[model samples]
Target: MTTVAYQGEPASNSSTVARTLYPAGSELPFTSFEQALDAVTLGAADVAVIPVDNSAAGRVADVHHLLPESGLFIVAEYFLPIRFDLMAVSGASLDRLECVRSHVHALGQCRKVLREGGWRTLVSDDTAGAAREVAELGDPRHAALAPPAAAELFGLRVLRSAVEDDPDNTTRFVVLSRAAVPAPHTGEPTMTSLFFCVRNIPSALYKALGGFASSAVNLTKIESYQVGAGLNASRFYAEIEGHPEEPRVELALQELRFFSTEVRVLGVYPAHGHRRTERSG
Candidate 1:
C-alpha cells in the first residue's frame, strides 16, 4: 500500500487531505514539510500530501521552492475547504483572553477578533498544534485559532466558530509520488505542475507564455522567483491543464522548449478541487 507523508500531527488538515487524496495508502505524519519530502525521498513513505496554497492565504512559496528539487511528482491535487475556529478551555470567555496563538495564516484570518482585546499574539508551527498546546497549557487566558475538528480532538472548547475572513477559503494540496501517473481521477481532467527558468529579457516571459495562448492550452497559474543565478537572473514556474503531449499541449511545449533556459513539467494529475470529500487513506 502507498504510504502518504504529511507535515504536522495527526488530525491536521494536511493529514485529512492525505487520507482524502490517497485512501488506500498508509498515512505518515512529519513535523515539517521538508521532513515529509525527506520521508518520500528516503522511501519511508510512498508519497507526500502537502499543502501548496490557500485561497485566502495566497501563495505558499516554500512549497514551490521545495517542489522543483524534491525529485517527486505531484500525482494528484486536492482542494480542502478551510474553516478556522477559536478554541479556548471549557470556561474561558472572549473577555478572559490574555493571548491568542496559531500559525501566522490562521492568526491573520481572525486578526480583527484577536486584535480587538489587545491580546498578545503568538505563532506556532500549525493551527492544530496550537490548539493542542493551549489544551496542554491549561491557561484560560490562552486560546488557539484552529479548526473546530481540531478543538474537539484536543478536548478544547470552541470559544467561537467559523471566524475566517472568507467563507469560501480553500487550501490546495498536492499528492507527491515517486513516479508520475496518468493524470489523477485514479481514472478525469486535472492540472499538471511545471517549473522552468526563462531567459532573462523583455518578452522573455511574454514569449514563454505565448505558446500556451497560441495553442489554447489553458494555462492555469504562473509564478516567478529569483534563482540567484548571478546578476539579475530569475526563473518562473507554471501549472497547466492536461498532459504536455496532447495535441495543443504538445505544440505549446514545443514552442516553449527553445525559449526556456530550463523547463520541466512537474506532473500531470487530477484536479484537487474535485476531491473535497475523499476518505480512502
Candidate 2:
C-alpha cells in the first residue's frame, strides 16, 4: 500500500482527507507540516496531504511560504467538511469536565459550546492529538474537541456532536507529490498555482496583474508575504482558473514575467468540486 504522510495524529482532518483520497494507503503522522512534506520529498511516503485554509478559521498553515521551496508539486486538492465534537473518557459526565482541549482553531470554532459549558480552554497541537491526550490521561475533568470519529479511534465517548459555531465549516487541503503530473490541456476545470516576486520598479505588481484583468483570467486566490529579511522583497502565491500553457494564461504570464523578478508555476491541477459548490452559492 502507498504511504501517505500528514501532519497531526491519526484522526486529524488532514488524515481524514488522506483517507478520502487514498483509502488503501497507509497513513504516517508527523508532528509538523515540514516533517510531513519532508517525508514525501525524502521518498519515505508517496504523497502528503496538507491543510492550507479553512472557511471558519481562515488560513490553517503557511503553505504559501513553504510550497515555493519544498520542491513538491500539488497533484490534487480536497475539501473536508470540518466537524468538532466534545469527547471525554467513557463514563465521564459533562458536568465533571473542567477544561476542553483541541487545536487553537478547533477551540476557536467551538467557542459557543465552551462558553455555554463554562469550560476552560487548553490548546493542543492538533484536534485528534488532543483526543489522544485526553484518552491517555483518562481524566473525567478533561475533554477534547475533535472529530466524532476520533472518539472511536482514541477510545473516548462523544459528549456533544457538531459543536462548531458554523455548521458549514470546511477546510481546503492540497495533495503534494515529489513530481508533477501532466495536468490535462482540456476536459476538466483546471487551476494553476504560482508564486511571483514583483520587480522593484513602481507599480510592478499592478502591471504584472493587469494582464489577467485584460485577459479575463479569473484569479481564485492571491497572498503576499515578505521573503526572509528583505522587507521590501515580497513574494505572492496565486491560484488562477487557467493552466499555464493555455493561450490567455500564457499571455497573462508573459506580462507577469515582464514585471516580476521571478514567476514560478507550482501546480496545474483539476479544480475541486467543492470550488464549484462554493461558486454556485
Best by TM-score: 2
Candidate 1 C-alpha lDDT tens digits along 204-252? 8778789889988877788777756666646767888767657788788
TM-score of each candidate?
0.90, 0.97
Q: Count steric clashes of candidate 1.
A: 6
Residue 133 deviation, candidate 2, in Å? 0.9
* Top candidate when judged by lDDT against the true structure: 2
> What value of lDDT does candidate 1 attain over all alpha carbons?
0.80
TM-score quality measure for candidate 1:
0.90
